[model samples]
Target: MTDMQHKPNGWNLPINQMTEEEWKDYFECRKKYDIKLSDEEIKKIIKIAMHFIDTDHDKYMEESLKIPVPPNLAISYKAFNGLKAMKKFNLSLAKETYPDEF
Candidate 1:
């Protein structure tokens, strides 16, 4: 198997090995900047972090879904999938909403 095959979705971060401090850091970074880490972004980040936390992916995802989407943003089904999926759907939606962005 290739390297990607050994990794979850070819993620680069070692999230499964995070310490409590790192977990706090992650949230702090997210909150400090008021970053709207969308569902997709959050999912990817969680996958990486969970790798560091050495937790179950399904449990992590389930727990994450309960966190709620950011205010003022509507989540498309595509975002629930992954980055690429969300990109395609988001791009199309953006075009539909603001053709000028295309």
Candidate 2:
């Protein structure tokens, strides 16, 4: 069997293992935009990044639709809205970083 342990995707680390440098870079890259992402928000971003490493952009978008809306109406509304915005942001970032794939 092929060993997928040392693949290019850095999935071996914990999902939330974003470094300070990564956080800075992420904000810097989007600095011109009006978007602001909190640390909690970045977790979802990282999750999407990891997902894309394993799958393709189209598959990621399709899977995002299946995210369960939160039970609390207020939270559910905000979460869904944030998800939509983040999806757009991530897509743009992906296109810039990996033009061939996105």
Candidate 3:
């Protein structure tokens, strides 16, 4: 699919093209629990996620799958949120850093 056709879930526009409201909505949707992450923290997490996705997708996926679901739905949801954010941000960074690959 063309880059324009393959946006992250719930993201109709590319990350770079998103408006402030859209960006906020996107992140808010991914936040499944009350746990708040600062913008800087999110950026750091995304950077780490991108590194893992670039250097060791297989291992990352394996480890991600091993994350156990907690008894509390909120906890489980938050974990899912974190993973989803990581993957989405990683894809965005990859596309930016390696445009030819896309």
Show model 3 residue runs off by greater than 4 Å. 1-34, 58-102
Tens digit per residue, CA lDDT, model 1, 1-102: 112223223223342333456444433432333233466876786566576445576665544443334322323332344322222122323333432211
Cα RMSD (angstroms) for every candidate in the order listed: 16.6, 16.6, 14.9
Model 2: lDDT to the true structure: 0.38
- TM per candidate: 0.23, 0.24, 0.25
* Cα lDDT of model 2 by residue, 1-102, tens digit: 002222213223353234556544444433333233465665685577568756687767554433322234323332344322332232333334332221
Better of 1 and 3 by lDDT: 3
Better of 1 and 3 by TM-score: 3
Measure candidate 3: CA RMSD.
14.9
**Pairs clashing within candidate 1:** 15-48, 15-51, 15-52, 16-51, 16-52, 16-53, 17-52, 18-52
Question: Worst ten-residue run, lDDT, model 1?
Answer: 1-10
Error of 2 at 96 (Å): 22
